[model samples]
Each structure stands twice: as structure tokens, then as C-alpha cells.
Target: MAVTGGRAPNQTDSDGRSELGKALRACRGAFIGVGIMSFMINLLYLNGSLFMLEVYDRVLPSRSVPTLVGLVVLAGGLYVAQGLLELIRSRILVRVGTSLDEALGGRIFESVIRLPLIAGGGGDGLQPLRDLDSVRSFLSGMGPSALFDLPWLPLYLAICFAFHTLLGLAALIGAVILIVITVLTEVLARNPLHEAMGLTVRRNALAAASRRNAEVVVAMGMTGHHTRHWSAVNDDYLAQSRRSSDLIGGLGTAAKVARMMLQSAMLGIGAYLVIHQEATGGIIIAGSILSARALAPVDLAIAHWKSFTAARQSWQRLNKLLMILPRQREVIQLQAPSRQVLVETISLVPPGSQRVVVAEMTFALEAGHGLGIVGPSGSGKSSLARALVGVWQPVRGKVRLDGAALDQWQPDSLGRHIGYLPQDVELFAGSIGQNICRFDPEADSQDIIAAAREAGVHELIVAMANGYDTQIGEGGHILSAGQAQRIALARALYGQPFLIVLDEPNSNLDAEGDEALTRAIRSARERGAVVVVIAHRPVAIEGVDLLLVMKDGRAQTFGPKETILGQILRPPPGPIKIAADGGVAKP
Candidate 1:
């Protein structure tokens, strides 16, 4: 099954287990080929013991130089073939890993972008990529090889038994001991390893947060405090990691010692059989080699147990995240919006809070109209703006555009006709033109220039060292705050969006910038666009035709701009009286 941006229409699995299963299934042929090569490699492995047996039993007794030369050549050829097969198997595994990464990386990234900002509290948004890397590393590493070689253990043990029953019994007992050691490693390391993983995730998040706020850290002389805080988290991570390592290390050492003892014991048993004339010296050598081969995979597994467990945990977490945030399916293509926005009794509560941030907001704007939202600092102006543009879903009621729910339209399709400038403006690292054009590969130069002109930033952009091609550093740090805000405004105005929502767009603008913004709003309205502006200062909303007054999460008044402004600035008829219940009363 092909992985896409959204959940597949026919996908019925709730947990997304089937998606992972499908990725593995795509690589089934490669794995099967690797399995076959492993079989050949194991068969060739026995040639060493067989060569020793023949040399001691036949060549030595016969003293035929030609026979010895012939046996050496045959064994040499088999060894070369085994090495070639091993190389091919490794290559196949590497291809499988890359292919799996290619298939899921894009899909996971798309899902991460679509995730609601509130839902992604304290997450760096790159965790999914890291999880994908963990899975790929496991697939191409020594862990899977050890697992593949495990099934051949019985075959090696059967060969040991063929040599002599006592040798076979010794090998079996040694294998059992190693298996027990493996179990012990898991039981002892499980909790500590789990704790270490959680600590690592938190540490990464802290580091990312600190980096993003480096300016504040330096300005407030918080560098020392941040360092100490990070160090504490790092120390905890190290402690748990050390605990896990100590247990695994002790068990690994024990397994090594036991394997060595098993080899010695096999030699002793072989010597005893030879003395009784029950077996030849050749069988003694062959039995020791076969017994060691039988236990090799078990030892390797014990050595790499930590990585195996980490990969398993990462897989489970990734699956759960994908299940919870499945991709959206393709929707029927709809025409561009016609600048009609309807918000019906929409209320919004923050992701983890019970208090309503936006309460029962009901409004409508037709083509060629502008609405200004004025409110106090905590009166939910920003929240209402976010809901209008579909950033935050309303807990109750709906936001409709062109007679359809906002969410009913595919996100990309809906986004094309909706322009939004958030309270905090940010620009990615790229050329100025790219940022203004929304990073569209097929963006038209004429349209980009038009947008910059519309936002009154075209002259500022052209004055830069490279004009429209000037490269903005990370988060547009190369430009001033005002410059960045203007560029973001230009981005929102690009493509002549049918509906535009600006949340405190002029927060960083100077007097001249303010004039440019007013002109831009007027121009949009002239072009039949429905514009919504959230502002604190009255001057910023001078050109708006309608006004919405918000206070304490409720609409205080809504009407033409002149009527609401008059009411707000006008005094009450008589002295306001205080009621017994501490409420204001008009008599």
C-alpha cells in the first residue's frame, strides 16, 4: 500500500499496525533473499570442521601431498563464496533500510505538520524523524543478522551430536546457559533503560527550547541557570544509562566466560572418547568447532540487547503516534473561496484547559467587507482569529467558508484561499522572494512582486543587498523585527486570498508601516476579499467597515464601525450605581 499525506480511505486498522506491516511486506523479497544467503553462509561455515576432519583422518594417514592440495583448494573456494554471500546480504539489508525510510519519512513529516499546535505541547516536532531513524538503524545493523542466524543453531547442534552424544549434550547445556543469561539481561535492564529513554527525550526538548530562546537567555543573564538546569537533566539520564549498562555488562561478561568454558569442556570430553577408542582425534576437533558455532548467535544477541530493546520501544511509540494522528484522506476538489466567511456560535477552549477562551462568537462577512476585532489583552481576540482560520477547532459550533465547513475542504485546498498573519510573525530561512511566495516551487515572479507591493515591502526588499533574492538567516534573524513582520504580512497577502485574517499585524510597524497596512487592507476590500483584523489600537482599525467589541470572552457589541466606536467613547446617561452584589447597575 502506498503511504500518502492522509489516512487511506480503505484503511480500517485503528492502530495503524497494518501500515507498518505493509512497509515490511514491501521488503519481504529482499529479506527472503537475505535468508537464503544466510543459509548458504552457514553451510559453508561447516566446511572448516569438515576440512579438519578430512585432513586428520585421510590426508595425514595417506600422506598424499596431492590429496592435501586438493582439499585446501576446495575449502578455500567455499570460504571465498561464503564471504561473497555475506557481503551481498549486508548490501540487501542496507537497501531495505533506505527503502523503508524513503517510504515513511515524507508521510510522517506531513502528519507532523498537520498536527494541531496546541496538541503538540512541548514537542519539538522532529521526534518522529528520530524514531524513523531508530527503526532503520535496527533493520540494517547486526541485531537482525543475529536473529536470522538463530534458526541454524539446531542444525549446528545436530552436527555435534553426529560426532558424539556427549559432545552434543555439552553443547546443549551451554546453549541453555546463554539463553538464561539473555533473559537475565532483559529483566535487569528493562526499567533502567526505559527511564533513560524518557530522560533523553526530555533533555532533547529542553535543548531545543533553549536554542530557540538564546537571545532571551543571554539578555536576562539566564545562561548560568539554563546550563545548570540542563545539567541536572543530563545527570539523571546518565545515571539511568549507567545502571542499565552495568547490568548488561555483567551478564555479557558471564556469557563470554561460559562459552569459553564450554569449549574447554568439549575438548576434554573429546579426549576421553578418543582414549576409549570410541572416536577419532578428528571428531574431537570437529565437535569443539561445531559447538562454538551453535552458541555464537546467542552471544551476539546478549551483546546487542540494549539496542534491540530501544528499537522495539521506539517502534511501539511511533505506531501509537501514527494511530492517534492518522493522515487526512484526499477530498473532492473544490473551487476557490468567494470571500464569504460565516462563524456560527463558535466557542474555543485551550487544548488542556476548561475555561473557554472564545465564547459563542457569531459573525458573518460578505465579499468586499472588513471586520475589526477590538478587545482587552485577555479577551480571546487571538483565539478567535485562530479559529477563523482553522488553526484551532471550535469546541462548539462551526466556521464555514463558501457554504462548507472549513475542515471539510482539504487543508492545502483551503489554505490557498485563506491568508493568516499570526500574532508572532516568523519567516523561515530562505530567499526573501521564497518567503513571500510561501516557498512555492512554481511561484510566479509577477505574483510575488505584486504581493510585496501590496504589503508595501517591495521597496524595502529591493533595497537589500540581493534585492528579492536576499537570503534571510534562520527565523529571519538577519532582518529586524519590523522587517520580518512586513515580510510575513506580504506572505499572507500573496495569491490574493479570498479570506484574510490578521492578528495584531501592526504590532511591530512604524507610523509609515501603519499607513502601508491600512492601504493594504483597503486594497484587499476593493478586490472583493473578506478581511478580519484583530487590533488593540483604534488607528489600526480605521479602515474597517464593521467592528466587533470583545470583553471577558464575550462579545460586548457588534455593528458598523462608527456606531460601536461611538458607544465605546460616549459616556453613560447617569452616574453608574454599584449593586449589592458588586455588579454595575444603570438607573
Candidate 2:
């Protein structure tokens, strides 16, 4: 939100020690090296131009026309080469950025995945990470490019000073005055500009979130509501953009004034020198051209900086994601779990929610037991599944894995015992084989096919024209909801785990798909891995050992399904049907 003139004052060196820092440091070096080469090219170009000017004045009348044409061509070649080099330097920036992207991007993902745990769990992440991404992209794209232009001005002034101290003094004064005006205008517009940028980032995040959840908006017939929200936010951003534009225009005016002053200073000083027989018109003309050519990139940088400022905010946001502590660490241990997971007094709070969604929950699942989690929507069935796998840490209690706290179980160790399928099905835009072997890259094709058959997705995969090799579009657009879910189940099955946490595995499944999933769950149980399924419908959880009803953030009852269904979940489908710790049920 500091886009409204707020900035992280102490962030300079704190986040600067990561791979991003190393990449940016390398970028800084590239920028300096490019600037030096650019300066040399510019110097060569000027020398050639000046030579041509001198040739025209002193030798054109007496020289052969062909020789003069050759001189002109050579000078044009220098200018052409200079132009090409500038273009090349800018182009190389894209590659340099790509290289850095590959090396450091995972760290950004890690940061986002980790920081929420540090901030008291998932409730403080989603929005901040979105904002961070915006800032990081803008900054990384073009913010530091100003450095490329910053160097040439001083060097140009020094060159002018070398020829004549008096002329150099005037040039220096003129440049100083220009810089002062630039700084003054920037300061004057600082508050409004920053506020406008903050609003812009906010609006952008809203638009992005809206776009992501567009299906829900459309389904609820809340299109008008969101349209109005987006329009108002967009208008605010537009207004701020106009204000920034106006400030730039005003700065342009100031630059115009500075240029006029420069022109007058050069001419008047040159006239004074000529009258006293101390200087010539040629010197003045050369000085003016050199100065103008030298400041071209500065002028260009000024324009680019206006664009770069917006991008700087974006880069900052993106970099923030890289700073979040990942929910899952990269640590791995070959040692396996010593005991099954035990939960006591656990709670779940989603990012950005004010109330705790699930609270003070306790449970112990003996190895090989299938626990059924039944609840109404918002009763925290999905949250329980995530917490068991340590996706979101419990707010009030510890989840012990293998007789140790979940964190003590090495990062990869939990994965070996734990496989989770969230309520919504997600698939990569790749083949079935790729999705199945995501965790085990070295998994054999036969093993992948076996897991697929176990999940009841092998037949579907065979139906596709490319079979297992067929590409699944984004989120498996080409496949049905049931197919994607089964594929996800297959992926979890591909890697052997001691525990399986499935959130609403039967959610979008047809009667046949549900039966298939139930069979798969039976297989996991037979294999001696504990299975926890977030159940919605009253399907026969025949293979499950015990069922727990979750209501009002606590375990309403712990007993057989027959005991809780009549008491907890089988209540009338109206008025939330309260069954928390024996409250009077609502109809």
C-alpha cells in the first residue's frame, strides 16, 4: 500500500542476501559495463560527426567529391554501429532477466509457501503474495534501467570541461540547473504519485482475484456487483495515472525551460568569447552538438524512468513473495516416520479470514485406520485435511508425526507418509504420465499405469486419442471434473505414503466414479496407510473404521457413523442444523 509514498525503509540489505540479490548485483554489473561501452560508442560517433563538420567547413570546397562521399559514409557507419550497440544492450537485458528468473524464481515460491506459518498460518498470505508479485514484476522489468543513462551526463560535462574551463563551467551550471528542476518536480508530486501507485496496485490485485474467481461471480449472478467494483477501482487508477502523466508533462515543461536556458548560455558565452577574440563559432557549435547528443539518453532515461517507477512497485511486490517462508521446507531425511500422526487441540485459520474456521480439535488415528470427517460447508473438513499434511499449521496445538512434532519430521519425510488431494481437482497442463509421476520423476511407466488403474482413471486415459501421452490443457480443461479428480488420486497413489488426506474425494464424482474412489480408498486402507476423507454426502463409508462429525470448530461427536449421522450430519438441511457439543438442533 506504500505505493502511496510508503516504502520499506529498512528493506535495503535485509532481503538482499538471496539468489535475487546475486542476480540483481550481476544486473548492476551488466548495466555498468553496457553504459561504458555505450559511452565509448557515443564518443566515437561524436568524433566522426565533428570530423565531418570540420571537413565541410575547411576542405569540402577543395576536395574531390568521391573522397568527401567516402568520409561521409565512414561517419554514417559509426553512427549506425552506435545505434546498433544501444539496441543490443537493451535486448541483452531480457536474457539476463530470464537467466535470473530461472535461478531465483523457486526461492520466491518457497518464501510465499513458508511465511504464512511464521505469520500465524494461512490467514495472512494470499493477498500479500498477490501484491508482492505485482511489485516484483514491475521492478524487475525496468526499474534499475535508469542506471544506464545516469553515468553519461557527468562524463559529458567532464569532457566539455577538459577543453575550456569557462565553457565547462557554463555546461556544468546548465546541467546542475536541469537536475535541480527534475528533483524539485519529483519531490513536489511525491505524495499524490505514491498514493496513486498504491491505489493502482490494490485495484490490480482486485481485478486479478476477480478474474480468478469469475466462475463464482457468474454463477451467483453477481456480475454487476463486481463490474461496478472493478469500474470504480479502475477509474481511481486512471485518475492517478493521469496525475502522474500531468506531473511528467509539467516536468517536460521544466525541461523545456532548462534547454532554453542552455541554448542562451551557450550562445551568449560564445558571443562574449568571440567579441574578445577568445573563442570561435566552430567551438560553440561543436559544444552544443556534443552536449545535446550526450544528454539524449538522459532525456530517454527520464521518459523510461516514468515508466520504470510503475514497474519498480511491481518488482517490489514480486520480490516480497520470494521473501515468504515456504510452508514446506526443502529439507529431506532418509529416516522414515516412527509412529503414525496424532492430532490434539488443533485449529485452522485461513488467510484473510477474521474468525477461526476450526478450533480446539483433537483426534488420534491409529495406523491403518480410516477416519471419516463429515461436516457441513465451512465446518473445516478441508482445513483438517490440510493441517494433517502440515499445509497449514494448527493455531493452538501440535500435530505430531511419528511421535515428534510435524516440523520435526523432515520436510520430505512427511510427503513419504502423507498424500493430499484438495477439494478442487488440479492438474498440470501435461500428459497423464507427467501428473502421476510428479513426485517421483524416476517412476516407471508401468508403475504410473498401475496407479492410474488403481484410481480407476486408467480406462479414461486409454480412451484419449494419445492415451497416457495426451496433453491435459490448463487445469485439465480437456477432461471432466471426475477424471481430473481421479488423476489427482492416482498421483497421490503413485508415491507410496503411510497416510492419505483426501478432501471431498467424491465431491464431483458420478455414482460410478464415487464407487471407484471408494474402492481406491479401500485399497489404501488395505495397504495399511491411514485414510482420512472429508465427506459431504451420506455415502456408505463402509471401509472406514470410525467417523467423526465436525461442527462449530470442534469435534461434535466421536463414534460410529450411526451415532453421529442421526445427531450431527443427518439433521434437517436448513438453518445450519446445529449439533456442536449438544446444542439444540435447528430445523
Candidate 3:
């Protein structure tokens, strides 16, 4: 069986538009408007050179003040029009970028959250978000405007050619040189820029890791060691960035210098033709302006080549990610499950892995009953918990709630009926009340307080300075581990879910916390909810009636809790006993 949110059935969609293309297509009108404006802006650009040519060729010879004044007014009007159109065009482009972001931001974030589950937590988690940022920045920046102006280069060159063949030839040569420089900039900067992008991801990951574990590092005197390692990665990233910058900067400078020299050459050629009586003095200045205008797009393109590359790369990565974890289609909502939780010979593999961690595990728990899963580390207890909560999918069988496969229900609807507290208790950066209600804006205050009471955290929360209004720091760092676990327990119990799976819920808890956890499980059971607790500690199972012991991804024992415990704790003739940590002990 395929994992949920894994590769789509059709990896390649030959007929469908890419997600990015679809987003852009939605804003096709804005892009078309930008194109029209670009055309008008380029057409108005001729006003300047033509005004100079007319003044030099006609007005200057006749010494006509009226003609000169008329030219100035006409040219100024066109310039103003051009500037207005350009401003509008730039604003439209920014809006287009914003629109695209609005359309795809939610989808991309959902993909980001699903990616780790599908890919087994490999690679950088924040990379997709970064890619989206790159794409948005490129679309909103001058890079796109420069690209739009490129088409006008040929028209400007044609005008230069119409002036005189020699002037045309000079302009043509300069354009060719700049185009070559642009190509070289792309070719040379590509690898270094790509390397730098990778280095940036690595550097960011390193810094995030260091910060996430700063307490451990500082307390253990490992800060210097991590710092040195960070320095090495930082140096590599900086070196690649510098190399790319230098290369692009050097080429951009070369393009600028070449365009200037070419403009001057066009003037020199125009002057030579004028002396030979083949062209007028006006042609010299006009040809230089036209040629410069023609090459300006190429220069701008060269300058923005780095951003273009980055945007292109980001687009490719986002495309691949979307393909791997395509948007989930709307599924029919299944009724809330309340009868029983069934694990029917289901085998599970970690996301992005072929190794089965929970193999052919079969067990069933009816409503109002509790099951405690006990096993040593790496025995797949946590994996089973994940599967039960639908965070993972089985490779061999199914997990059904009240006779309906979990996948048959829409994710959010199913989530509403289920509660899961993972081994690592994580809370968002919000007030405790918000976190308890799962950020549901319509959550009732009475229900929130009831959940806290059920989790035995209401008194603890009331004792806090801000009570439910207290803001938990990132990852709930503001609260101690025991406090976070109790709050998390409250979150799980918020809606009186049909199923509750707790993985090592008491690992960070003290005796009082353990009592609170036991009470919460009993309260859930009293409500006819299926409660499954994964724990290595014996005290955690004190309230559970049933037990499932796991070993090497397989169930080794399953029975009433007392029967299983008696079998486990019975003397085996030798001096060995069961240790508290689920290991063998010598007496």
C-alpha cells in the first residue's frame, strides 16, 4: 500500500498545467496589461532621439524658436506618459506577485508540512518556504521588467540600422558583445550560485540546530565545538557567495563598459559619414542614442541574471515538491467513529523508508477501554502510536475506526475525532488558551476550561501569572517540560475526541503529573473514547486494563494488563529480573 501524501499516481502530468503556471494563468490579465504598457513605454522612448534629430536637422538650420518649443513640449509630454505607464506597470507586477503568493502560499505550506511525513524527515524542512520567497521576490522585482524590455532591443537596433549602415553595423556589434556577456554571466554564475544556494540551506540548518539545542551545548561545554563546526560551514557558504558575486559583478561591469564604448563608436561612425556627406550631424547624436537604448535591455538583463537563476531554481524545486505531494482532493466526510478502534494486521514503515517498523500488528480496542503499549526502545511502540493517529500509513493493512478505514475520512474531519500527544510535546507560539483550542477561533471558553480540568491542569494554569492568557514561547519553551505535557494533554482532550493516543506522555512528568495523566485517560475512557498509551514506565499502565508488549516491530504479548504483567514479572529460575527501563537486570 502506498503511503498517504506520497507520490501521486501519475508522477508526470502531460496535459495539466504546473501549479506555478496555473497561478500565473489566473493573473494572465495583469501580465497582458504589463506587456501592453511595456510596448507603449518602448515606443515613447523614441521621442527623445527623434526630438534631438529634428532640432539638429530642421529647427537648428531654420533657427525657428516656435519649432524648437513645439519639439520640447511634445517630447516632455511623451516622457511623462512613459513614466506614468512604467509606474503603473511596476505596480501591476507587484500585485501579480502578491496574488500568486496568496493563491499558492497555503498550498505550499501544506506541502511543507506533509513533505517530512512523506520523505521520512530527510533534507531541510524550511527549504520549500524559502523557494516560495525567492519566486515572489523575483516576480515583484525589476528583473521581470528588464525581461519585458528585451524584445524592444531588436526594434531599437533596426532604427539604428535605418539611420546608416555603418552606424547600424557598430550598434549591431555592441549588441552582440553585450548579449555574449549576458550569456557568459549566466553560464559562469550558474554553478557557483547553485552551490551557494545549497550552502545557504546547510548554513541555516546548522544555525537552527545550534540555537535549538543551545541549552544543551552551553551546559555541556560543547558550544565552542559547535561554533567551530558552524564557522567551517559558514566560511564555505560565504566563499561560494563571494565567488558568484564577483563573477556576476565583473561581467555586468564589462557589459556596461562595452555598451558605452559602442555608443561612442556609433557617434564616431555617424561623424565620419557626415564628413563624407553621406549623413547629417543630427544622425551622429541620434544613432548614438538609439544604439544605447537598444543595448540597455541587455545590460539590465545581465545585471538581474542572478535573481533570474535563483527564481528558476526555486520554481523547479517547488514544482517537484508539489508533484510528489499533490494537493489532497476533497473526500466525503465520514461519520465520527465511536464504537471501536481496530488494527487489522497492519504493517507500517517509516515515511521514505522500506524498513517495516510495525509488522502485521493486529489488535482491537473497544470504546471505553484503554490499551497500554510497552516495549524497549526501537521496538516500534512510537511507530504504532503514529499509525494509530494516522500520522503514518500502513504498508500491509488498515486502521479502521468504527468499521471505516481512517483514509476514508477527510483529514480534518478525522482529526476532529482523534487526539494525539506525541513523544515530544510541542506547542505553538500563542496563548495557552489558543493552543488548547487548537487555534480554533470559534472554540468555546467553557470547553477550553473543561479540557484543562479534565487534564488536571486547570489549577496549575490558574496559578500562572496570566492563567490561560499566558503566551508560550516558541515550542513552548516558556513552560517547564511537565507543564507543557499537561497543557498538551489539555489540548488533546479539548473536544472530547473519539480516540486518544499518547506516546511517552509521562516521560517528563513527576508523580503528580503521572496521577494527572492517569486521571485524564480514565476520564477519556469514561466518555467511551478509545485510549492508547505508549509507555516504558509501569506506572503509566496502572490505569489501563489491556496491554500489548512489542519486540523488534512485532507484538510479543497481548492480554489483560494484570495477566501480561504477571507473565513479565514472573521468576524464571535464574537471578535475572525485568528492569524498569524494559531491559533485563541481574540480581
TM-score of each: 0.94, 0.79, 0.95
Ranking of predictions according to lDDT = 3, 1, 2
Question: Whole-model Cα lDDT per candidate?
Answer: 0.88, 0.69, 0.90
Window of ten residues with lowest summed lDDT in model 1? 1-10
Poorly placed runs, candidate 1 (over 4 Å)? 1-6, 9-17, 116-118, 574-587
Give the per-residue lDDT of model 2 (tens digit) for 186-266.
676566667786776678667777786989999999889998998998898889878877887777676666766676776
Clashing pairs in 3: none
Candidate 3, run of 10 with poorest lDDT: 1-10
Instruction: Give lDDT tens digits, candidate 3, residues 476-513.
Output: 98999999998999999989999999989999999999
The true-versus-predicted C-alpha distance at residue 338 of model 1, in Å, is 0.2
Give model 2's clash tally: 35
